[model samples]
Structure formats: structure tokens, C-alpha cells
Target: MINDKVLSIILGGGQGSRLYPLTEARSKPAVPIAGKYRLVDIPISNCINSDIKRMFVLTQFNSASLNKHISNTFHFSFFSSAFVDVLAAEQTISSDKWFQGTADAVRQSMHHFLAHDFEYALILSGDQLYQMDFNQMIKKHEEANAEISIATYPVNAKDATSFGILKTNEENVITSFIEKPKADLLPDWTSEVSEEMKGEGRNYLASMGIYIFNRDLLIKLMDNPDTVDFGKEIIPQSIHEHKTVSFQYEGYWTDIGNIDSFFEANLGLTDDIPKFNLYDQKQRIYTHARILPTSKISGTTLNKAVIGDGCIIHAAKIERSVIGIRSRIGKESVVINTYMMGSDNYESLAEIDKKKINILMGIGERCHIKNAIIDRNCRIGDDVKINGGKHLEDKETDTYCIKEGIVVIKKGAVIPKGTII
Candidate 1:
């Protein structure tokens, strides 16, 4: 069981501008993944698997969908003290603006956290995909008597430029840090990981944006009104004054920051041996349990595809794709290398006929779509062709868009018949 000494705070990113259109309507964490689960489920499921009870998610942009998902999905028994609640950015007499940064977001919501009883405040990023047992990290924190402990993963020289890299002594005490440093600017000092980590070709310790701080030390750190971000301001300053240390995690961790990364991560799940496993019964990812019929397929061919529940596939060819719930594909259509976020509700035969449209809520017959993202509630007409590879740079229109060679049919978009791009 998770001890009462720890309380968790998940930082749902501000605005999520990097993950555009996907974050267009919902917050970053609320963006759905793996065909059924939202991005937030990764962190929350990790906490639940670790037996942690009390957790708060802080979000500032487009939080209505996120709030509704959390409220409808997670419910603790009346007898239990556990709760997963959202603390949105609100203006009070003391604070007038929205969350300026990660640190500021937590600082603004300190009142809600202070009301609860806990010793250490565990901070985590909501957009990351990974599974970890926090009890182990907390145990290390107490053993080292560290005022602050940051969870770290080793990264190679090529990938090191995109993360917050740090130098530590042999004892794992952090000495210096650099945020998104150039290769030449990296610190000379190097910390050693276990033999297991060395096998993975990891050379530098990259911060996972996960931290554990003593309750009092956290409040004191946030006391300064000027320090807004942790990686940019607070962490660099804390190395000298606080007993800061690193807890090494040599596991699969992916930061779903932008559209390219998000697309690749989702498609990676279709690999023969995926790095991140969603089938582990001991530590399974949880989400809203929607009641729907089993997926029905007739004369369809699928290869390396993960299809969700309540889908009707009719003589379609789907390869290397992740199809979401309530999806419908008509005869002879081909979907290749796509991430199809399916419809919210299924349309009946009567409703489909009444509309008299070429497509009804899903892909139409004889359509050829490749390397694209079909957002929810899309009506792709028959004979429509969308090839992200054709338009490599970027193009945006009311009907469709191409970002980084990935065609994104906007949410609720209606593509007419014989449309080609």
C-alpha cells in the first residue's frame, strides 16, 4: 500500500500549443491515445498501480473535457480517502492571471494541496507515457534524506539536446544542470548508472520532469514570485542549497510533446515488440469503461493494426493503423499508416439512409487514405484520396490540413466525394 506520507500533483501542460489540433478542443492530457485511453490515463494508472491514493491534476487551458473525463471515470468509495480531482486556474484576489508556467501553476494551487495531509509532494508531467512504481522512488528519497529527488532517464548524445541534462557525482547528488543544452555546452562531469542501464547505450542523465520534494521545502521554493519554471529557474538554483539527488529509472519513457512525436508513439504500439507494453495485467492502464458491442468485421483484412471496441469494418484494408472506438469503414476502402480517432456515437442504418450523404460518420467506400490522422466525428466521402506524403511541408484549409507530412482531417470535417489531395 502507498503510505500517507506522499501526495501527487500532475502538471497538465499550459495551452499545449505544441500538440496543436489534437489539443484544439481538449487539454493535452485529455487527448485520447491507444485507440481508447486519454493521455492522462498513463500517469493516473501509474499512481493507482503504485497504490497512491490522493492525487490532483492542474490544468489551465480547455479543461472542460478533461474535468468531465476524470469525474466520470474515477470514483473512490465513500469509505476511502483517495481522490483524483482537477484544480483549474482560477483568479483570486491574490493571483490575477492564468498559470504562467509549471511552477507557477503549482504555486497558485497550493491552497488546495495545503488542505490535505501529506509529507512529500510528488510532481509529475501528465503528457508522458510510462509506468513506474512511485513507492520505490519515495523509498529512495527517504533513504538518502534528500530534500528534492528528480527521476532521471539516460539519453544518448543525439537525443540529449532536447532534454534537461544534469551532472551528478558518483553518489547521485546533483551538482549542475542545463536545460536543452548543446552538445559542446554539456557539463564535463558524468554520473554512472547500473550495468543494466549501460546496456541501453545511455550516456547522459535526462530529467523526466518528475520530482519529489519535502512539503515545507516546496512551499519555500515557490515563495519567490519571480521563479516561474522549474527546469529553467528553480531546479538550477536548488542544487547548491538543497540536498538534491537523482533516482535513476531505466525504463521506457516517451514525452508526447508535439504532433510528430505523438504520431510516432501511437504507431510504435503496432510494432512486433513494442517498447511500452499495454498488456501487463499487473500494471494495466485504466480508462472509462464504455459499454459497447464487440467490433464486427466482415471480409476485412488487417495487418499490424489495433482496433478498439464497437467498430464495424466492411471489406476494408487496414495496415499499421490504430483505429479508435465506434469506427466504420465501408467496402474496398484502404487505410494505411493512419491514426483514426473514431466517431463518438454510431449511426444507425436508418439514420445513414436518411442523411443520403456519400459518407456517414466514418470512411466511405473506395477511399484511399495513407499517413493521416482522422480526428473524431469525421465524414470522409467515397472515392476521396488523402496522401500526407504528397504534401510534405504544411498546408491548412477548412476541409483538411497537412502538418509534417501527416494529413489531419479536422474534427467534425466533411470531405466530399472524389476529393483528392
Candidate 2:
């Protein structure tokens, strides 16, 4: 099978400054999403469903938690070669610095990749939310005898400016490329999309930043030290010289590039029919198999809410929210439009009763939290009111950050009683 001859490299992006406190302790791929799963799970699960078992994730900053997560989550038969390995930026005899860019990361890690026997490399971004069958893309690449294949998505003109636009010929072969082209330049950059996409005013094809490179070609490109990025340096320079084709994909794909996008992606799971389907059994998202008790709720009126395992709730109402594992909400609390990442462990009731701990690791009584993200193991005191909206200005405190009206309580933060934001 072609899958056996394919290797996957998922790029865990740089410092992730846009994500702020969320990325402070972990790498971008290690950042949690949809309550239960990490950002890296999306790409790895896609490869698993496609039967591309052997994979490597490359990350540089704050990779300790990322490494630990992968080590604990993915396990295969002892006799099989299936494995997922993380390769952080390392100092070798040739280079002594961190990974400069996407291409440089691969270049620095080429020694490990070359040790494996593979004909093609399926490069993917770790921070994207999408499900795709990579087998079809590989098969198409073989049929076209293309040296490189890029996944493209049809987006509207308004969104085209934010992405690297590709111009393709009638054969679906890329002819030219422009990175974040101006609005006036979009008229010439439109590509052939399906009737459904055209009707949706999605005539422009945006590069999805997913690519497949023939092993030999990737090796050749990596040798050039000057070229340090795929989307900026490799794709544009190689399109006219190499047989590069575009694989147009029409699906629910969103890049978790910033706090706004990340927050929206999680809350979208609460929709009646979400664009990104998490309930599809055939294409299920894989994650750490934790042995946890079933979530328990009382006096909580849940409407369009997704509660994860091992939650103990007493909230008056939870609407349009995602409550994560081991979450605990107190009486009369009203939580709306929020993503509450649950605690890592239940605080010993004995400790709380003994007053050994002042505030417990959960929301307190009579608190009203809206449009906020309470990260893992946060402690909220009683009678607190946090109303996050566009009316709030962007600011950062020791325990929380306000960005675009979303109040993100940092992990392990302690909020005093009778507080308001």
C-alpha cells in the first residue's frame, strides 16, 4: 500500500505569541482544544484514519508537555512499526541554533527522516482543525506524476487576503503563487472551484499549508540552506520548475492561529450542526484514554452544552458552553458562552473541609461567567461576576487576559471572592 511508503511530519508552530498565556506553559500543538483533546490530536488522528501510522511531530518552544502527551496517548502493537515521535530543535555538528523556519526545521531534522524508508512526505500543520483522507491525495499525486502536491481550500475574496493564494491552470497544476495578496490583485488570482463553492462566493483558492513532497524532491530542496519556509520560499520557487499540483478540498477547515479563532473553534462544537463534526463515528477524533468517572450534574439547565467526563455541576444554567473533564460548578452560578477546561484532579474534600485550601479548583456559588475561557485548574471564588464582551478593553492581569472581549483565566489562576471583570 502507498501508506506504508508515506511518512508524516506535522509542524508544531513557533512561540504562538498570539495565544498568550495558553502557550506560556506548552507548545502550540500541546494547547488543549474542544475540552478533551490537544491541538496535535487533529492531524495525528487524520493520519491514523488514513492508515498512515508512522509519523513525526516537530516543535521547538515549550515542547515538554507536548512530548509527554504524545508519549502517553498513542500506542500501537509491540510488533508493529507504527509510532509517533516528537523531534525538537537540536544542536548538531552543522547547525547550533533553533529552527529558523518551516523548511529549516525539516532541514535540521532530515537526518532522522532519511533513516526511514519512504517515498513521500505528507507535511501537515499541527494547529488546523480538519479531517482529510490523505490516501486520495497520495494516489492523485502518483497519477499526476507530480513532484509536489498542495492542499487548497476555496475561500471568499474577503478571506483570500489573509492566506497565500495560488493560481492554477485548467489541469489543476499550480502556475503562480502570491502570499497575502492585495484586494486589487485578487481579480487575477481566482481559480476553478466547484459550483457549490462558486455559489458561496468562494471562487478564490487559498493554500491550506498542507503539502506532499516526493522524498527525493524534498531532500533536494532541504539542501538549500537559504530557503527556510515552504509556503514562502519552496512552493513559489518550485512551482514553475517542478510538477506541482493542487488538491482542492471542500470541508470544514479553520486555522487556530490566534485567541479569537481558537475560542470560536471550541464554542462551535456546541452548535446544533457544527461545521466541524465531532460526532462522526467513522472519522472520530482520538485522544488520551483516561479512566475517569461519568460526569454528574444537578440543578443545571444545560442547553446546547457539551460536558466532558467526571464533572460535578450545580450551576443554575449552562448555555452555549463546553465544560471539560473533571469540572465543578457551584450553586446558582450561570455560565454562558464559555469554555471551562476542567481541573486535572478533584481537590480532596477533606482538605476543603479542613480549610487547608481557601478556594477550590472550580467555579463558586452565585457567579455569572460569560464569554470567558477558564483554563485548567482555575479557582473562582463565590459571588464573582465576569461578563466578557466587546465592551471590555484588552488587558492582561496576573491571573487573566482580556482579548477582544474574551476573558481567559490563566491556568491555575486564583480569583478572590466578590470579584468582577
Query: Which numbered prediction scores highest in TM-score against the true structure?
Result: 2
Please give the TM-score that candidate 1 achieves against the real structure: 0.97
Candidate 2 per-residue lDDT over residues 324-355, each given as its tens digit: 99999999999999999888888887878887
TM-score of each: 0.97, 0.99
* TM-score for candidate 2, residues paired by index: 0.99
Give the runs in model 2 whose Cα sits over 4 Å from its true position.
353-355
